[model samples]
Target: MEFQGARNFSIESPGNDVFSSKYDDDGHVKRTGTWVTASAHIVTAVIGSGVLSLAWAVAQLGWIVGPTILTVFSAITLVTSFMLSDCYRYPDPVHGSRNPRYMEMVKNVLGGIQCQLCGWAQYIILFGTSIGYTITASISMVAIKRSNCFHKHGHEAKCHAANYPFMIIFAVVEILISQIPDFHELSGLSILAAIMSFGYATIGVGLSIAKIAEGGNHATSLTGVIVGEDVTSQQKLWNTFQAIGNIAFAYGFSMVIVEIQASYLSYPILYYSTQDTLKSSPPENQAMKKATATGISITTLFYMLCGLLGYEAFGNKAPGNFLTGFGFYEPYWLVDIGNVFIVIHLVGAYQVFSQPIFTLVEGWCAKRWPESNFMAKEYHVRIPLVGTYRVNAFRVIWRTLYVILTSVVAILLPFFNSIVGLLGAVSFWPLTVYFPTEMYLVRAKVPKFSVIWIGVKLLSGFCLIVTLVAAAGSIEGIITDLKTYDPFN
Candidate 1:
């Protein structure tokens, strides 16, 4: 369904005053990020190591269907992002109030039960995502080390891809980085992450071009593009929908949009910025639409290039990960460099995605234990212009423990592609399809069961069915994979 940017309408409820947005003194928009920064944030948050799997995902669909799936999902995500953007404004202009958190927005529209469920799902999905990043980072380090060893010893190199040491190292680094107070604080990192994403995409594309030039056309056409005789009907069906799920996962960033927008607006109108800032000098709607469009378009191009090239290069034999599949070429420095870029990019991305969870959990804790020391304000050291943040001992302890836990889980499971698929299945419908559409309907007061409303419901139901099937397949795949690898190996 097409969502218009101009149709943003406010909703008023008597007890909605509890929702608030934060602002700076003098009420100017305190955290107004430039379009460049917002674009960077979107790129960093959306394009994780997930793109490394796109070639394999599309390989399941062949050249014809693969690109179609990528383009279709990209448009869907862009439309949902617009639906979400409209909700960032205040429900009541006079109160100048806004819901800065996704959970808050869900609570405002769908009521408390759904809001609680959304909060749970959001944190779980984000945490699962962080685990996927940790696995990717660890595996990338392993690939780099293997490449370096092979360069020195040729066929005699005995390189192992162990998860524990690198997982520990990655976890420690993430623990240090995840301590950043807010999204705006991590803008510089986001920019670097964007650059790193581009670096990896370039490497993937360049290598694919080189491989094709070398006549590396050793691929079986199991994807039903050229001929359907190579595989059974069941195999084709499974791979086709599996490919759809992977594409959906690749575009699953809707849950984090509200948090990213928070960086642009500082806080919503309720917290600090005035209604004048919202009505008069606020960031232009078109500017944000452009930013969102530019970021997603660039990402879609990169994903398609990597998917098409990798599929054409390796065909049905394409490895689950594009970079890992490159291991057949010995002593390739480009492979090492690309893997390093992946590690760096995932590190930055882990923060971009995890910070929202941190914000929501901390806010929940502060409210739940108002009288406890866990909620008490304390002093933190200054970081230049950031000034001394009012630190809480609980924050340092809890967020650290949380990172450690996710790291441990990654080390234990280390099921990279499967975990990503699972998380994507869980998030795609609620965060991407259902919640945004439902909330928009609520905000716009479109009558229930009308043509538009029934159409939305039917669409949402279809999405949920597809995702459920996807989740089941992903779970089964993980079970099969688990039999092949022991924990921490």
Candidate 2:
């Protein structure tokens, strides 16, 4: 296969398979999963620390464009997710494998080089997201502590809320909890993360509505936020782009779709002993579609409610984090509670999102050091004299170091707005829009310039352009803001 001048790999090619499904001498058996489980996993992937900042995202655009942008992206995400799900399996099952990781799918559908590019993009996005979580959790902790100190000590107390010690402590917790081996093992954590997400969303919306009902004067529009009737055109344009970037970051979840699909054990045996082409069981296909729809719809509702109410409450004054935007006000306790949940949720969310990264790195390392002791299992006596447990020496040391490095970066930067925006601007289009669209076109054998094909290509082009502009705008914003904290500045 050829895409433009590049040599593409056929997903049905025997040698290009992602998953190596094993078979007994007699026949092959595959695992399958339920839609409900997939839906839960999707919810876990989509609803993360980003939700905390969506009101601030909405504040970037006025109420009119904010929700609209969100809805548009949500729709696009659903469409892309469906497409990607369809591409999850090779048409000729015996020739290939199922639930290829995102980059694996890219490799099969696009080419090896494109796969490598997708791999880099995926790592950057997920690593940035993990860093974003560290920043979010640390900052939320800082705010919670500051809120507590202010209530107890009033004006005389001084507190270093955003300090290294807190981040170290937070990082330690993450390092400890991040040891879960795979996405399938995260079912309980995902459910808890989902619940925590709902709890915080409810708290945010509840607080926002309460504040709005107080009948106080508040800045409500972009003009008011900028504080001038003579605001320049460039500033408005910049603000719009930044808002789009932020919303993109807030809504970003495309990187984890393949991993989520893989979590389903009911692996669709899309090919039969006789058939060469793909034909998924109707129930499996419909389950995935239904799960993707239901999960995204639920996520969208949570985002909309939080964004609408939080922006309505604080309007122009809204901070990047809704809980942190509360200031040292009357509801300090609720703010503290919300911030704690944010930290907890980010911990689980970080692990969920980083699973793919961990898998890739571990696989590469294991491949390189097939006989190393680091890859060997070591048993340790269990606490309370229960039993023995096995541990991976490499995983412990490597992931701990990974968490520590991320924590150091979080402590040094400690800012979320521009970092997340920049990351989203850099990675969202390729992962969420371009790759899926292109893969679908190729796999479905849709002819070039046909109506549906043309529309998809246009969308892909538009998304690519948007991400470039967004990256530039976000980078500029980060540079400008970094002047305040840039060590060498």
Q: Write the per-residue lDDT of candidate 1 for residues 332-419, one digit (tens) a residue.
A: 7889889989988888778866876788788888889888876667766877976765566887888899899999888878876677
**How do the predictions measure up, each by TM-score?**
0.80, 0.82
Which portions of model 2 show Cα errors greater than 4 Å?
A: 1-37, 92-97, 153-160, 178-188, 222-224, 227-236, 261-283, 374-381, 385-393, 486-489
Summing lDDT over every window of 10 consecutive residues in candidate 1, give the lowest-scoring window. 268-277
Model 2 lDDT tens row, 130-178: 8888887877888888888878888357855545677788888888777
Best by lDDT: 1
